[model samples]
Target chain A: MTYCVGLFLDDGLVMLADTRTNAGVDNISSFAKLQVFSTPGDRMIATMTAGSLAVSQAVMNLIQEGVQDPETGETATIYTVPSMFRAASLVGEAVRQVYRTHGKAMQEHGLSFDVSILLGGQLHGRTVRLFQIYSAGNFIEATGDTPFLQIGEHKYGKPILDRAVTSETNLIDGIKLALISMDSTLRSNLSVGLPMDLLVYRKDHLEGPSLRRITEDDEYFLMLRKRWSEAISEAHRQIPQPDWGF
Target chain B: MTYCVGLFLDDGLVMLADTRTNAGVDNISSFAKLQVFSTPGDRMIATMTAGSLAVSQAVMNLIQEGVQDPETGETATIYTVPSMFRAASLVGEAVRQVYRTHGKAMQEHGLSFDVSILLGGQLHGRTVRLFQIYSAGNFIEATGDTPFLQIGEHKYGKPILDRAVTSETNLIDGIKLALISMDSTLRSNLSVGLPMDLLVYRKDHLEGPSLRRITEDDEYFLMLRKRWSEAISEAHRQIPQPDWGF
Candidate 1:
């Protein structure tokens, strides 16, 4: 299990992903789930994945090595995609290829070929975009009305994102909300662990993104965790008590 | 789908369940998922169901009509149970009986014989107890350290319960937490909807626990929903921003 969230805001994109992966309770391990492909001054695309580690890893490996476009016979890679749209299509195509190869064998063993990908970034001449690419190779982009996308262990952390995020939100605030959302998930579920990767991509700047590896020793995250829990309790305390004869 | 939660505290028990059930997005309806079996001063047992409507309804019907105790060859009902532990077993037995009768048939029809129950209350002369009964007729009790249990669409509402609930929490605060938790689920999930049923059982004085059917017009619930969302946003606002230089 993993928890990855991406926020598409007015200024940029805020992406975060947990490193924990597990087949069973006893087989837990840490592996980075955030991948970046960038060309200085041209494009900076970030993708986070969730679901079957095997499927996601295979898809990522194919994308990193540059997959061939089935129709054109030309190599299409995340770094070389002409637009953010094509980048999403490339990722989706990679997923389909992996499923086509492994889906049948996995199903026989009662394993799912499921994987979800969140693609976010900007191409030099194109507008910033965010997409949620599914296992079936179809994708949905986040628009102004719905400005965020999440994959894996999503429900536990969604209420906050649903209430606090919007297209007009600032990148810093978006990062804060993403962390709070991740905090809620980490607290309630053991599958999504710490040492998360956080990346912020400023809309027009293609000179790469600010990446931070958040771990237990990080002072800011520690403060945020403590304060967020206290704030929630304080807020819970302030809500007017039921007046229907408690 | 349903979102039902039960909290076991030193003072009493808090139980809440949403009413909406659906086979598909278009086939939705409101059906009471909470049931109370009380024998005045003798006992009061509240059970909340989640999962296949058919399985839950069948189990409820069997419990309501009194299931036979295989060991004693006599009718065993919630009202006749000697202790809260036995009451949980009674509900589990009812569920198993339903599964015995319909499990294979339901599977053949591409349906699941899936149902999870949260049973909480007290039997006179015995201790107050809360049990999360599984589909397989087994259950685990809520202890002092982990004093709450939830089922169906539960993840969205679990963080608050994880952080704020405990064995020492008073019934009023417990009920407040439960409502806030339910509010989270209601906002994030369409499958769990309005007109929830709430019940609170105080230890020892089992004379029909307090019950409230919260509908869209309920003033207290509406206020709680509004204020809780505001509180969450306010909390989000207060968390210190990243100092890593935007």
Candidate 2:
């Protein structure tokens, strides 16, 4: 299991994802889940995927190929899309294509062709947007009321987001809340591990990777871990005791 | 959906459950999920159920009827059981009975007759014990290593228990933490709601309850809600901001 979150805030956007991937408990490996698509000032899109690694890799590979090849006018690629919505559609098409290629073989082996993705970015002239793409190759956009989206082991980390996140939140503060939410889940569940990947997209910047790669030993995450532990214990101590008799 | 938690500590045992029951977003009702059985100084066992409400209700009804009858050769009804382990077994048997009687009928309607229960308390000469009974009538006892157990909508409230609960913690403090855990879930989900029922059990004293019935307008819970919000926000503010551009 993995935990990935994407936030679309008024100031910009924030995305975070864990690096642990496994076929089973003993087969764990560190794999980067965040994929960045950029073309100078034209567009910038970051995708963080969760579920079966095979299907995600197939979809991502098809995307990279489509973007690199400028041949016969085939279905549009992320780089060629004029709008964020079209870019999301392009990603969905790739997912469908990958399913046509791998779904049958996976089913024969009793494995699901499961894959879901968090896609967010900007197209130079338009506003920033975010989407959660399902395995069925369909998607839903994030609205102003619910500015954040999460996948995989989401429940343990959802309460913090429900209470603390809002559309007007700034990028830096959004990252802080995202990390803290992940911190809480990491403490409670062993399936989601460290070495996270995070990116902050400033409003209209069409080039991604503003900031990336949080290693296991990053000082900020370490401080966040220690501080969160202390904060929870401190909060538990501060609540007044209930007055009740036996 | 439901949220119920049971804790076994050196000071005593604490069990809390929300009253909200829903067949979907529309069919909502306040159905008590907790059942208490005590035989004076001999034993005190509390059982909290979650999952298919029909199945759980049937299980509780059976147990309630068993205590009032003499024909059912089940000598191990919770009220008549001699030890905490036997009482837990009785609860497990009740869960299995419900599943046997209702499982197929529910399956015919494309429903799962799932049931999970949290049982905790003590008998005359034993220490407090908490067990999580499964649909199969199998159960596992909580140890000092994992002192608390939760069922249904558990993830939203788990971080607090993971961080703050231990066998050495005091009974009143345990109850407070349990309430806070429930508070977090209540804030994040519509499926879990009030009026909450809480029970505290002393190690050897059986018979009646210690503290119960936390209604919506209860002043103590209201104050707890207000103070906890303040405390958490304060804790967040008190944690110094990251020096690195976060």
Candidate 3:
């Protein structure tokens, strides 16, 4: 299991992903689920994956190596895609290719070919865009009405995002809200653990994104967790108790 | 679908259940999910149910009528159970009986025998207890360490309960927390809807519990929803944005 969230705001994009992967309770290991493809000023594409590790790795490898268009025999990769929409299509094609290769064998062994991806980034002349791609090679973009997309262990942390986040939010506050959402999921579910991979991409600033690896002892994260907990306690305390006269 | 929660605390018990039942998004209706059986000072028992309406209704009817024990050739119903634990077992037995009668036919029709129940209350001379009964006729109790149990669309409302409610929480505070939890689920899930049933029971009093059917126009609930949203926004505003120099 994994928890990855992406916020496409007015200022930029905030993407976060946990590193934990487990075959079972006893077979847990850490694997970075966020991948970044950059050609400096040309483009910067970030993808966060959740689901079968084998399938995700295969799809990522295919996208990185480039997929050929059957109609034109032309090869295109994430770094070379002309637009954000094309990049999303490239990722979706890579997923479909992987499914064609392994879907049947996996189903024969009683495994479902489950995978999902969050693709968000920008090209030099294109606008910053975010999308959530499904196992069927279909995808949906994040719009102004819904500026955030999440994959894996999503429900536990959703209410906070639903209540607090919007497209007009600032980049720094977007990061804060994403981390807070991640914190809720980490506390409630043991399957999603740290260290985490975070990327902050400023819209139209194609020089590359600011990236950080958040570990267990990160001071700012620890403070945020503590302060958020305290703030919630205080907030609830302020609400008058129901006067049902029970 | 339904959303129901039960809190077992030092002061007593707080139980809540939503009334929405839907076969699909287009077919939605309200049906009471909470049922109470009390003999004034003798005992007071409450049951909140979720899952297949047909299955839940059948089990409820079985418990209301009496289920006969094979070993002693004796009949026992929820109202006649000797202790709270026995009452839980009676509900579980009713569920199993329903399965025995309908499980095969439902499975043949590509339907599941799905149902879950939350039973909480006290007998005249016994201790107060809360049990979550499953479709298999198995159940688990809520302990002092983990004093609350939820069923049906539970994840969206879980974090607040995990952080706030405890065995030592006062009855009034317990009611407040439960309502807040319900509010979260209501906001996030369309399957769980309005006209909720709430019951509050005081330990050892057993003189019948305070029962309320909260309609959409309920004043306290409306105020709580508005205030809670404001409190959350204000709480998040106080947290410092990440200083990672992005």
> Candidate 2's error at B52, in angstroms?
1.4
Candidate 1 vs 3: which has more TM-score:
3
* Candidates sorted by TM-score, best first: 3, 1, 2
lDDT of 3 by residue, B106-166 (tens): 9999998899999999999888999999999999999999999999899998988988888
| Residue B102 lDDT, candidate 1, scale 0-100 | 93
Best by TM-score: 3
Instruction: Give all candidates' CA lDDT scores.
Output: 0.90, 0.83, 0.91
The positional error of residue A94 in candidate 3, measured at the CA in angstroms, is 1.0
Instruction: Identify the superior model by lDDT, candidate 1 or candidate 3.
Output: 3
Evaluated at residue B100, the lDDT of candidate 3 is 94
Better of 1 and 2 by lDDT: 1
User: Number of the top candidate by DockQ?
Assistant: 1
Candidate 3's residue-wise lDDT over A158-240, tens digit each? 88888889999888888888988999899888889999999999998899999999999999999989988888777677788
Please give the DockQ score of every candidate, comma-separated. Answer: 0.78, 0.63, 0.77
Output the better candidate (1/2) by TM-score. 1
Q: Which pairs of residues collide in candidate 2?
A: none
For chain B alone, what TM-score does every candidate structure achieve against the true structure?
0.96, 0.92, 0.98
Residue A241 in candidate 3, Cα distance off native in Å: 2.1
For candidate 3, the TM-score of chain A alone relative to the native chain A: 0.98
- lDDT of residue B185 for candidate 2: 96
